[model samples]
Target: MSEADSSTEAAPRGGIRVGAQKFGTALSNMVMPNIGAFIAWGLLTALFIESGWLTGIFSGLKDPGGWVAKIGGWGEYDGAGIVGPMITFLLPILIGYTGGRMIHGNRGAVVGAIATVGVITGSDVPMFLGAMIIGPLGGWLMKKLDGLWEGKIRPGFEMLVDNFSVGILGLLLAILGFFGVGPLVSTFTRAAGNAVDFLVNHDVLPLTSILIEPAKVLFLNNAINHGVLTPLGTAQAAETGKSILFLLETNPGPGLGILLAYTFFGTGNARASAPGAALIQFFGGIHEIYFPYVLMKPRLILAAILGGMTGIFINVLFSSGLRAPAAPGSIIAIYAQTPSDDFLGVTLSVVGATAVSLVVATFLLKIDHSEEMPDLAAATAGMEAMKGKKSSVSSMLTGPDHSRGPITDIVFACDAGMGSSAMGASVLRRKIKKAGFDDVTVVNQAISNLEDTHDLIVTHTDLTARARQSTPSAIHISVDDFMSSPRYDEIVDLLGKTNSAEGASGSPSDGADPTSDSATAAPPAGAVATAPSPTQQALAVESIVLHGTATTRDDAIDEAGRLLVECGAVEESYVASMHEREKSVATFMGNGLAIPHGTNEAKSAIRRTGLSFVRYDEPIDWKGKPAEFVVGIAGAGKDHLTLLNTIAKVFLDADEVERLRAAQTAEEVRDILTEE
Candidate 1:
C-alpha cells in the first residue's frame, strides 16, 4: 500500500539486506500461523476450564463454575463431549490437522490431525506437555503407516488408506475409548478435579488472577501475560467448547491501550492493528489477535500487560462479567456475575486497563524502528520464492563426511567479525569437546582473506559475503544467529559428515572409530581433501551390543545385543545376555525409536553387545518409540547415555530423516545410521 510495501515486492535473489524488511517479514509471517494456533488454543482453553473437574472444583467452592461453566456460554458443551474422555481433548489435533491441510495440503494434513488427536485422546497431562511428549509419538506412528502404504502398497492406495484409516481410526478410537478407557480416564480426571477444588477452596480464591496481573506488568509479566495467561485464556475457550478465542475478546484492556494511543498519536499499520484488535477483542474475545501489535513493539507490551493486570485486579476488586458468561472473564462477564453494588469495579478494570495500554502505545509511536523491518512487498515475493526453496534440508548434505575433519583446523566467523559468527564458533567448539571431538583444534577468525582456505568456514548473513569471497570452494555455511548457528542442521551435517568419514576410514569392516592420533594431523599443503564417499559414510555407523541380564526396565540392553551381531555384526558372546527373558517396564519411548541399553555387571557371565541395521517389521515402543529401526551405542566405563546429546542430532535432522526413511534394506539403513 505504501512505497515500502510496493518496492518490497522485489525478489530477495542476491546480496544481503537483512534490514527492517527481514525483521518485519519474519514478524508478519508469524501472524498467520499464530492466529491459526491461537484459534485452536481458544477452543481448548475454554474446554478444559469447563471440564467436569475444573468446574466441579469451582462448584464445590460455591463459585458456581462462573459463566464459563454455563450451558450456551462460551464453555458450553459441544457434541463431541460425550465421545471421549473430553470434548476439548481432541481440539488441538483437529486444529493441527486442519492447519496442516491448509499449510501442507492433503498429503500430511490428516497425519497432523490424527497425530494431534492422539495427544488429547491418549495423553493425561496438560495440553502443552502432551504436545511435547505424545504429539511426536502420534506423528511417528502415522509415518510408519505411511511407510507401509508407500512400500507395500502404492501412493494412490496409500493416500486412500490413510484418509479412510485416519477417519475410521478416529471413530473407532472414540468408540473403543467409550467402552474401555474413557470412563477410567474421566473418573481419574474427576478425582483430579476434586483435588483442584480442595486446593483452590482452602488456599487462595481467584484473587491470584488479580495480583498476578499487576505482578506481570512489572517483571516477567510480559511472558506471564502473553506466554501464560493469554494462552491460558485461549485454552480456556477450547476447553469450554468454542472454536475461536472468546476469552481474549472480552479482555481488551491491553490491546485497547495500544489502539487508543494510535487514535491520539501518529498513524502506522503496526499501531493500526491495535485499535482493530481492541475492537474485536471487546466484542468477540479474540485476545491473542492483538499479539502482533505488541510483539512488533515489545516495549509497549509491558505497558499493555500492566494495564490488563490492573484492569483485571480492579475488576476483580469491584465488578466484571455480564451477559453470556464471557470467555475471558471480561469486565462485562464479571459485571454480569457480580452483585449490583460491584458493577463499578468492572468499569474500572476495563477503563483503567484501556487507558494504560493507550499511553504506552502512544509513547512508542514517536520512536523509530530500533531494528528496521524488511519492505513487505519485495519481502513477500522473496518469501514466496524462498518458501519453495526453503530447502527440504536434505539436498545440501553431501553425504555424511561434509567437512575435512579430525579438527586440526576450526574456523569461526560472524557478520561483523564480532557479533554472531564469533559467538557461534565458540558454541561449536564447546559442543565439539562435549561430543569427544577433543582432538580437534579451534580458531576464531573473520572471513576477510580470499586465500584463507580453512577446513570449514562458519559465517553469518553479515559476514557471509566476506566468507564467500575468501572461500569460494571452501565449505561455506550460513547461519541466522550466533547462538543457533552451530545447531543448524546444515552446519551439524557438514561437521558430522567429515567426522564420520574420518572415523569410518579407521575400521573398514565394522563401524567404529578407527583413526589414530597421528592420522588426524594436518593435511599436506598441496594435497586435496576429498569429500566423503558413500562407502565412507556407511562405515561411520557405530554398533555396541549390550548382553547384560535383561532388566525389568529399558529394552535398550536387549535390542543392543541383538543388533550387535546384526546378522553380520559378529561375536555371539556380545549378544548372549540380550534375550535372557525378564519383564520390568518396556523400552517404550512411545514411538518406533528406542535407546534400549543397560548396565553390564560383573560376576555374571553376561557380556554386553550393541549392534545396528535391524529393522523391526511391526513397530514396538522401545525407549518410547514405535521404531523398527534404531542406532544403538554402548560404552563400558562412563555412562553411555551421555552420547545422546550428540546422537540426538541424528534424530533431529530433516535431511538425515529423509535418507533414513528412504532406506528399505539393512545396508541402506546402515548407510544412513553410520555415525556420519
Candidate 2:
C-alpha cells in the first residue's frame, strides 16, 4: 500500500486554500534549492562586513590591501568586495535557474539563468524577487513554445530546431526581463520592505506570528520563510546589518515549548514520544515532529501562536535580529546567525516563548481529561490532509511500537492481493532478508482478509482506513511507493534496534537461513518435461502493446482487459471487475505506472494467471496522476505474483523504466519485463 494516494479522504479544502498551498509550494521550490547560496552570502556578510567580527579582530591593522579590507568590502578597497556581487548577481541567478528547472528541465534552467542576468543588471538592489518571478516564467514560456512544435519537426532537423528555438526564446525573455520585470519587482520589494518597517515601528511585528505559527503547522513554514521572508530579509540585511524577518518563522522556541509541554503533561503515546520529539525539534530542528501533537488537540495551536508572539515581542523590544536566515531553525543555527550584541536578547526571546508556550500547552492538556489516548495516527492523517502530502518525518510519531513485541509477522494489503501488494511484499521481503531478519515472515493479502493477529500491516494510504478497521491492533505503515519507499529502511532500522535491545536480556534467536537449499530447491530430478509456471507463460510479445492509443485510464484498462481475454487468461467478466476495483481505489501505482487488476471478490472470473502490458506514447491520466505504463493483471492462482514482483523490480529503477519506454517493439518490451 502506498501513501501517495490523493487526499480525497482528507478534510475538504476550498480552491483558495489549495491554490495558496500550490502557489506557496512553487515559490518555496525556487528558493529552497538555492539556500546554500543564501547561507554563503549570509556567512560572508556576518564575517566580512565593515562592522563584522573580522574587522574588530584586525581593528588596529594598517594594511590597506590586506585580506580583511579586501574581503570585507571596507577600508580603502570597499568597492572591490565580493559580498555585493554575490547577493547582487550570484544568488538571484541560482534561484532563477532552479525555479526554471522546476517548471521545465535543463533547458528551462539554462534559459532561466540567462533571463535572470537581465534582471540583475537592471536593478541596483538585489534581484531575488525578480529571479523568482522571471525564472519560472522563462521556463514556462519555453515549455509552451516547445509544445507548439513537439514531435512536429522533421526527423533530422530536431536538434537544429530545438537549439535555435531555445536560443531565440531565451534572448527575447532576457530583454523583456531587463526592460520590464526587473524595475517592476524592485518597486514591489521596496513596498513590502516598507510594510515590514511600518509593522516593526508600531511594535506590532509580533502579531504576524498569529499567521506564521498556524502556517508552519500546516507545512507552509518553508514557503513562508524561504519564499517571502528570505528575499525580504536579504534586501533588508543588505541595507542594515540584519533583518528581524529572518527570526520570524525560524524561531524554534514555540515548537520546542509545545514538545516540552507534551513531555511533561501529555498522556499515553503522546507523552512517551514527546521527549524524543523535543530533541529533534530543538536541536535537530525538524519542527514537523510536533505538528501531529498540535493536530491531536487543535487548541494547542493557540499555545503555538502565543509562544511565537512572545519570541517576536522580545526580539522587537531588544531590537535584535539575525544576520542571515536559519535553514533548520535549530537553537544552534539561531545562535550562529545572531550578531554578537544580540546574544542576550535572542536568548531571552527563546526562553520567554518556551515559558509561555509551555504554560499554555500544559493548561490545554490538563483540561482535556478524557481517558482515551489521543489518536496520533488520526492526527497524523489530519496533518497530511492539511499539507496535502505524506510527511516523511511525522512517521516517527505513528510507527510500529517495538514494545508490542518483535515485528515477526508483516503483511501487505491492497485492493487486490495479487497486484501491487504482492510487489510491495517482494520488495520488503528482500530488504528484511538482507538485514538478516530471516526469522520475520512477510506476506501479502487483500485488505478485506487482514487479520488482527499480524504484528504489522502495510497498505496504501487510501486503503489504510479499511485495513485498520479490520486489523486495528496491528501497527500500520502506509506508503506511496511499493518498490522504493524510505519507510522500508526505517522499518529495518527499527528491527535492528529491537533486536539489540532484546539481546541484552536473552540469547538472540538463530534466524532461519533464508539461502538454504530447502527454500530455493528446484523440482525433483526431471523424470519428464513439465509445463512452465503460470508466471512464466504470463508474458508474450502478443500480450505486450507498444505505442498504445488509449488516451484515458478507462480506455487503457479496457484495452489491457481485452488483451487478457484474447490470451485466454481471464473471462470477460474479469474485465468489468478491473473497472470496479479501480473505482473503489485507483490502481495508479507510483513511478509513472498503474496496475489495473480485479478485486478479490472478482477472482472467480479469472481463468488463469496472466498479465497484459501496455506502454502509451503520452501519459494517461490515472486519478489525476500521470501513468505512461499500465499493466493489467489477472490471477487465478499465486503464480502471477512472481511476474508482478519481477515487473516491480524493473520499474523501481528509473533507468529501466526509460529503457522499457524507449523499446521499439513488443518483443523488446517483453524481453525487458521477463529479463533477470
Model 1 regions more than 4 Å off? 1-252, 259-302, 313-352, 360-557, 561-611, 621-626, 634-676
* Residue 391, candidate 1: C-alpha displacement in angstroms: 20
Candidate 2 per-residue C-alpha lDDT over 1-676 given as tens digits, one digit per residue, 9 for 90 to 100: 2222333222343566655666677888888777777778888887888888887777887756588778877777777788888888899999999988877777788889999998988776789999999999988998788768754677577679878987888888889889988889889999999999999999899999999999888776767788899999999988898888998988888988888988888787888888988888889878888899998888999999999999999999999998878888788888888887889999999999999999999888888866565788788767766765456676678774456767778888886688878877877876777677766677888877777899888887667656665765676677777767888997777777665543232322365332221111122322112434444588766788887877667779988998999999899989888877876667777788898988887888888788899988899987668899989998777656556666877877789998997899887887787665
Q: What RMSD, rounded to one decimal, does every model reach?
A: 18.4, 8.5
Model 1 lDDT at residue 527: 21
Candidate 1 residues 311-388, lDDT tens each? 655644442333122434344443433323334665676788788777766667656435463222232223323221
TM-score of each: 0.33, 0.69
Predicted structure 1: lDDT: 0.41
